[model samples]
Target: MPSSSRSFDIAVVGAGICGLAHALAAARKGKRVVVIDRDAQANGASVRNFGFITVTGQQEGECWNRALRSRDIWAELSERAGIPILQRGLLTIARRPEARLVLEEFLATEMGRDCKLVEPSALSAYGDGLNGAAFAGALYSPHEVRVESREAIPLLAAYLEEQLGVTFLRQTVVHTAAPPRLDTNRGLIEAETIVVCPGDDFHTLHPERIAAYGLTRCKLHMMRARPARYDEKLPPVMSDLGLVRYLGYAERPAAAALRRRLEAEQGDQLANGIHLIVVRSADGSLVIGDSHHYAETPDPFAPESVDRLILDEYAEVFAGPLPEVSERWIGTYASAPDRLMLIDCPCDALRIVLITSGTGASTAFAIAEEVIGELYG
Candidate 1:
């Protein structure tokens, strides 16, 4: 059935990061935009994932460029929207010799040009409580910014409502049909254009449409550390344990060999699922995580063994007293086989977009630009 006698210019289903990106893009184009979601507040993967707008680790070429552009947009929005940037740089601490070699090769690439190799002597300036002994050196990328996602998502939603004049139908499930007619819980909504950004919950809405995408869910565990007064100057750091995961390293030929060696040497740890990323919050606390477990259905409970593995890496990296745990949470996101992000037009009026690789905060804005250009152009 037709929604109204008339139709909106654009209707966005799912108010997570991706959907919001679409809504923002359409609204910026001066289109009448409405964002519909089942929750009264914007949550899900957008709020659950790290609010780190990381440009350095993104895949090379378009993905990297998009992240860079999106990082700039995030900075602008943070300033305009009053969202706090918790930190502004990323330090990948190299613990293994192979990891160091991998990073050295990465520096030769175009992607690594913007980053600097930091020696132990310079580490004092970034943070004091950190154990420089565990690391040979680090690759410092100053292009990224971190925000508290728990706060930022709601703030972004509120900002959109107040500033962009985009209407939001909260606590509403929008059932979509061709030509973009929606039977929302609130009421009827119809649009000439429709975009769906369902995050990992694709099964709920368009299971058939997403099945061919080979969408798998990845479960991650994260812990929020209690606030500690570190030497006032530590930068956000990631362990070089899985340097291969980051694009800067992955693009280099050395990374392949290094990954193979690490996988063999650390086969058991890798099998058990262990990697290290330590990001600090605004209050001088660290948010550390995580392990990867891929499956169609993921248990929400974080495994103790995985937590132990993460902490073991953390303890190896930081020499100071262990920070207390303030909170712990589990997050899941969609993973695509080929693309970090999936953008498809199932029909002329319907666009299905997914951040298949959990890079939503880092690349959503840029992806939105691409989607909008495709639709409107």
Candidate 2:
């Protein structure tokens, strides 16, 4: 049998970005940390995402602040861990006059610092192939960064293990978290404290706690495409559809008018929860996505119609011909309408944290710091 007396200062369940974030936080405090994951390697919504650390369009107050802090942390880790940041900054294309109004309204807020509304004539300076989009204006924010999630997550995990002395028990299913002992399939893992960062598979550890909040899973369809010709690099691009989705702009009074216009013009895309966020990779392939559908149990399907709608939005925002799709996949994450994330302290030594907003990549680092601080301090 396995050893039943092994222990750690902190035991983190689930080795996605959320768990790694907690591990990093604890390790920094000189705590002996052990992270356990069911997967053989890093594979989940955390790695399947665009790896965009967005600051400008997050919900105005706390989320935006968390994104800023997380972005700074990403910057530090990117350099220290040798993760290449593919792009810096965001270029939000305003396709309608009402969308431009939302941008202007956002610019007036404290959250809009270092962001400006750009005229169409200035769009070419940001990158190439802009003359094709039917844009009214654009919003440029210098505070965003994009990385290849497929590459960064593994690198971050390695850095944590080799540099910070964190332990990883991969492919080990954690059945219980009744600290200072975790009951796993492999054996018992003892720790003074436990934090659960279950990424959408809520039933594994604390189904009751997760269900109490009426949590559900949101499935998104994403695809990668190879652009026809290599041109000047383009920053991440978003459409008017996003103005009605991201709260920094969507929550504004001006967003109402834009929403109405979109409903009239692009009702199908809106109903499907389709938004355009096109970011280029280091290899000139553009990673684009995604449409949202929420259910208690989301089907693992990526519909062609959904992809068509996504491409339609892409065409509306960018002038060039649609690129040939190279890969397609679906990603699901814990989601809730009431909150972006939840941190429940079942006890002083146990914490259940879940990022319901699909913002795990964008915000988990700050959330981890908060959780660790509360548990330790």
Show where candidate 1 strays beyond 4 Å. 1-7
Q: Over the stretch 1-377, how does candidate 2's per-residue lDDT look in tens digits? A: 24643689999998889999999999999999999999999888998998999888899889999999999999999999999988999999998899999999999999878998899988888888765346789999999999899999999999999999999999899999988889988888999999999898878887888888888899999999997864546789998999999988899999999999999999999998999999989988989999999899998878899999999988777666889999999999999879999998888899999998968888999999999998889
lDDT of 1 at 203: 72
Question: Could you tell me how far off, in angstroms, the CA of residue 318 lies in candidate 2 after the best superposition?
Answer: 1.9
For residues 1-377, what per-residue lDDT tens digits would candidate 1 score against the true structure? 24453368888888988888888888889988888898988768788777888877678888889999999988998987799988888888887777877778777778887898888777777877667866778888889889888898888888888999888878888765456577766666778888888888867667798998888999888888864555545666787666877665676777777778868776655775567777777777778887778888888778778887788778878876677888889888999878888887788888889998868999999999889888999
Each model's C-alpha lDDT?
0.80, 0.90
Q: Count backbone overlaps in model 1.
A: 3
Best by lDDT: 2
Report the Cα lDDT for residue 302, model 2: 80
User: Model 1 compared with the native: what TM-score?
Assistant: 0.94
Residue 222 of model 1: what lDDT? 85
Candidate 2 — worst ten consecutive residues by lDDT sum? 1-10
